[model samples]
Target chain A: MFFNISRYLGRFKLVGCVVRNFLILLVGLVFSVNALANPNLGLPPLNIPADNPQTAEKIALGKRLFNDKHFSADGTISCASCHQEDKAFTDGLPVAVGINGQAGTRNTPTLINAAFFETLFLDGRASSLEAQVLGPMLNPIEHGLQDQQVIVDLIRQDRSYTEAFRKAFAIKVDEINISHVTKAIASFERTLISGDSLFDRHLFGRDHTALSSSAERGLTIFKNKGNCVTCHEISWNNALFTDNRFYNIGVGFKQLTPVLDKFIAFVRQGNNPDYFPLTAVQRSELGRFNVTKNLADIGKFKTPTLRNIALTAPYMHDGSMKTLEEVIDHYDIGGDQNRFIDSKIFPLHLTTQEKQDLVAFMQALTSSKSPNHPTGE
Target chain B: MFFNISRYLGRFKLVGCVVRNFLILLVGLVFSVNALANPNLGLPPLNIPADNPQTAEKIALGKRLFNDKHFSADGTISCASCHQEDKAFTDGLPVAVGINGQAGTRNTPTLINAAFFETLFLDGRASSLEAQVLGPMLNPIEHGLQDQQVIVDLIRQDRSYTEAFRKAFAIKVDEINISHVTKAIASFERTLISGDSLFDRHLFGRDHTALSSSAERGLTIFKNKGNCVTCHEISWNNALFTDNRFYNIGVGFKQLTPVLDKFIAFVRQGNNPDYFPLTAVQRSELGRFNVTKNLADIGKFKTPTLRNIALTAPYMHDGSMKTLEEVIDHYDIGGDQNRFIDSKIFPLHLTTQEKQDLVAFMQALTSSKSPNHPTGE
Candidate 1:
């Protein structure tokens, strides 16, 4: 009887253990799948905004809106007109040309990794991608739309768009708004993550032969003598190739020097509508000062990522330089010496071979994964 | 002869146009691919830190380190002991039990979607995951390592770990440091992104059948009468269900109120070694004030994400409540009501059915994707 009772007790104990383990296993199974990440770029997962999550339908809608020229005043140009996918989302022009052949002040910056940026535009004006899309859409010199209502009305007119909006956002046809339009565009832009470069393979993938000897030497120079790493940073694990900070590298400072005080005084007095939509020549030189209106921020522009630097031509906020060689030469001479020049800017005294190597290294930084425009047919 | 010359000119123009189009097509082809995202959770891409990019090898290494019990002083427990994968990376205990059943001050918070957080821990002391992992490793009641060097030494002693480190980081055996261990663990932790909840499907995925009618009504109460939306925010596009701010709901305030003045005065003195490793009872009551050392911040705790709330039970910073019904009841009565209670904690006066619906809605938030423990064999 004692033996029978002990066996029953043992069976009960076994049952308890089994149930406990099963519960744990069940819990583990409930939270199992891994999220997506860009390991090739050594990039962490993208920090998607809580308000505007990505959906296949929304991304498709955004691409349509981005390429649609109807949003423009004369229906002559679109966002794709300036941010062409061919030249790493840049127009490859010295300055952006809008409808009617009208040129904008600043160069059209690459939208390659704009999703990772803290602030948008060269001057660091807009804070979010959602906020940044509206600036160009409503800018008098760009898309030239009068107000946000016009964008909403234009989107509302299209039957296909209304259906697409309904599918993506689950909102009624009448409820379609400007924020919805920008949200779609921003979602599409976030998908433009460029990684899997030759450089990434050499470093992250542990492939020694991925980079050429010249490029390897250039990488050393970039981190050391060139001092380019101060602005175009490459972290120990990943390389965004940008510190995301503003600096006056003395580009376009020459033209602004004479009229500096007057511009500063005018900007200090808020609500100066006349100061805005400045002539292309004057706007090019205002740099970050245009956004912050701070005298200290004058001539300072955001450090552009060097990730597909080889494809983008006419570098700098003004798109002054035509080639990488010209940019290096400018840096070699400690930039165009101006009072607001960044402290890190100094004469590098690099040799011809070193300069060529630097260019080679930058060329290797181009991603193997190109940004595809999924028409979403 | 004039007609022939005109035809030749037309042919030349056609050839030029073809060449231009081909070049544009080639550029477009060179930059064409999309990055990854977590839309099911209404989450943007994860904002990976540049210094600790994710790698499969590194994530594997981190999993090994996280599960290894040898790092602890007594070799009885590991990080996994408390942050079990089954319970949404949390221990269901009222407060964390460390080496030799040493109870900690605060509850074991869930590691699910920790990668989305700006500040870590209930007190919001640690800034980065890399930095936060070190706290438990060295804490007397937790992993109980003497210093960072001990962790480095422990890993070095393991030949398999040394080999894995070489593969993951491309560093020599001797170069293995505590930072690398933390980086690997943090990378693994970042992958624990819990989304695809029924709530996400109903809202972001446009699946009307995802939630019951009662749960749907609960969502309305959560947003309107409950005033939960003021803190547990759900944006139009996505829902993190948290504003990522701190507030006091008076959970452990009763135990803290009498000795609050004494504790505040002692904390203000600063640099008091005796004050540290406060008894679990005392520690649980400090809340946000422990980190900020400010009177205004006393008894406040971070607003936890409700993404996987159904799985992580015994709610709040102290883990006082045992069920969803109890949690709703506490909120309905405007929480425990203390001197430091948040103004938003006014009486909700929710009906019994409304309370049940809220619980039902929360249960619907259980993510379909569970946090898997990839052993990396």
Candidate 2:
């Protein structure tokens, strides 16, 4: 009887061990599933507007609108026209030509990773991408649309669009308005995020080989000798490459004659026709002043991200400097000192080798591959 | 004697089992280390150019040059002046303003992620980024440099620059030429890559939350309803968002009168002195045809990538379209019908909901975070 009892006890111990091991394995699997399903992916979630919480249907609708070219008067250009896919969503030009072939007074900024930007436009006029979306539709130089009714008419004409609207929102087709357009476009724009640069790999993933030694050294110079970090600022998490601030780097310092003064004054009051009579030439010269009434904002422009600087050329707010060397020269001199120049403008006194090092580092910022979306079709 | 022998045998067996367990542990450690060091982590290795292999010293030198603005004629512009890091290395403007405040015809392109481009410039004039570096330096409308010797002189005058050259190239300071400048700038450009987009996570990494359902639907529309992927092919591996081709979408149709045609023909045949006489207006009208004498290539502009379309607004080659909606409207009509319009130009009868869906998809392309680079003090 004692021998039988001993055998049974041993068997019971063996079964207990097996059960514990199985339970541990199950727990591990559950934990892994939870980890895989983590929605944030270790990234900070975006602060979407209250009215436009990110939804699958809304994003889909916005994307369709983004690629559809039916919003213009002539139906010949789409959002993708100026903002193409390969050129970081920029048209790759010195200036943007609009609906009637009318040229505007600014370069197209890259939208590759623009969702992080605090303000929009070269002059920091629009506070958000959604707010800025409506500015161009109303501009005579762009799509040349007369009013909101034209967009509504175009939408009402299509059944598929009506169905898509029904699926995205409960509102009827006739109820669709400018706010809806902006919301959808904003939703789409918020999704364009670019990360995983060589620098990011080096810093975040601890991949030393991601950046060459020279590039690493250049990064040091960019932070130190080049003094680029003063304004550009590398964050611990993300690097949008802009301070989200405005400054005048002395691009508009041609002697302000009577005509120029009047133009400047008019632009300072904003682009509103009620406050000022702006000529075509004057309108072109209206930089930051057009957005803000402050004189200090004259020639002051919004800081852009440096994510894909090598591809976009004819540098500057006016697209004047052609080569990177010329651009470096301008900054080396602190932007042709003028009365309106920002106080931050000061001689960098960067050595030629240091300049080259900075350039090398910037090149390292370029990616070896482009991002492509999977086509369900 | 029998008992002693049995005890010795049992001890020997115990020692043997201990040794076996130790060996197994050692093997497991080696395997774990190897797994941790695995180089291929889902993504392919970066492609470095054979002509421009990455090196520590070279990148350092390039960074130095990138920050040095003395390379310009007036010593007022640096590569950083227009391509400020804070501004994503772009001066906020519809058109670039160059030396002596001369305004350029197009908007400044961002240098971010530019190394992947097969050809440089909006018109695809320069075949390589390296070749493009010098075009702007010598262009009368840009940096306005007299010749390459000026750059060499500027370098020779700086002691720090000379020392850096010796360390980077093992050559004398005087040996620095335009080629060296271009190479450095190009090397730096190569580093300006943008990876880690939300779409990348959604597709490649199998992160389901990377894209909203609306964005996913918009992606479908971008491929099917919008027919955008026809020209803007999204790669399987990298989503560059561009096919890198040229097309004429009727940008300067009104400007292309019979007189304009004769003048363009004169310029292309190198006989403009008698017919067009190089007037400012005539010179400005010579778009892509001036670069490639192919008549079929007239008015053809390079297709841009749409990675970050929302941030860089005032769309098109002329900065005319103020909003994405206007851009969509223009494309709905397949561009103004003209003599040299692209065959792909056709009216896309999209619904209002579809337009909104498209815009939402575009917003989804925006990055939630920005890049982090060292800022200048």
- Among these predicted structures, which one has the highest lDDT? 1
Candidate 2's C-alpha runs over 4 A off are A1-44, A252-278, A367-377, B1-377
Candidate 1 structure lDDT? 0.79
Query: How much does candidate 1 score in TM-score?
Result: 0.47
Off by over 4 Å in 1: A1-40, A262-278, A371-377, B1-377
| Residues B1-377, model 1: lDDT tens digits | 53454455556698856655666576556532111123245664578999988889999988888898998999988999999888888888888989988988778999888888888988889988888999999999998889999989978988998999999999988999888988999988888886767787787666788789999998877765676765676654467777677788778878777776676677667756246545557666767877876566778899998877877887888888889899989988878877677655656678999999999899877776664312210
lDDT of 1 by residue, A185-303 (tens): 99999988887677887876666887999998888777555767656866545678887778888898888777766766676676563455455687667677677665666788999
Worst 10 residues of 1 chain A by lDDT: A31-40
Give the DockQ-based CAPRI class for model 2.
incorrect
For all candidates in order, the CA lDDT equals 0.79, 0.65
iRMS, model 1 (angstroms): 22.5
Model 1 misses residue B55 by how many Å? 55
Please give the lDDT score for candidate 2. Answer: 0.65
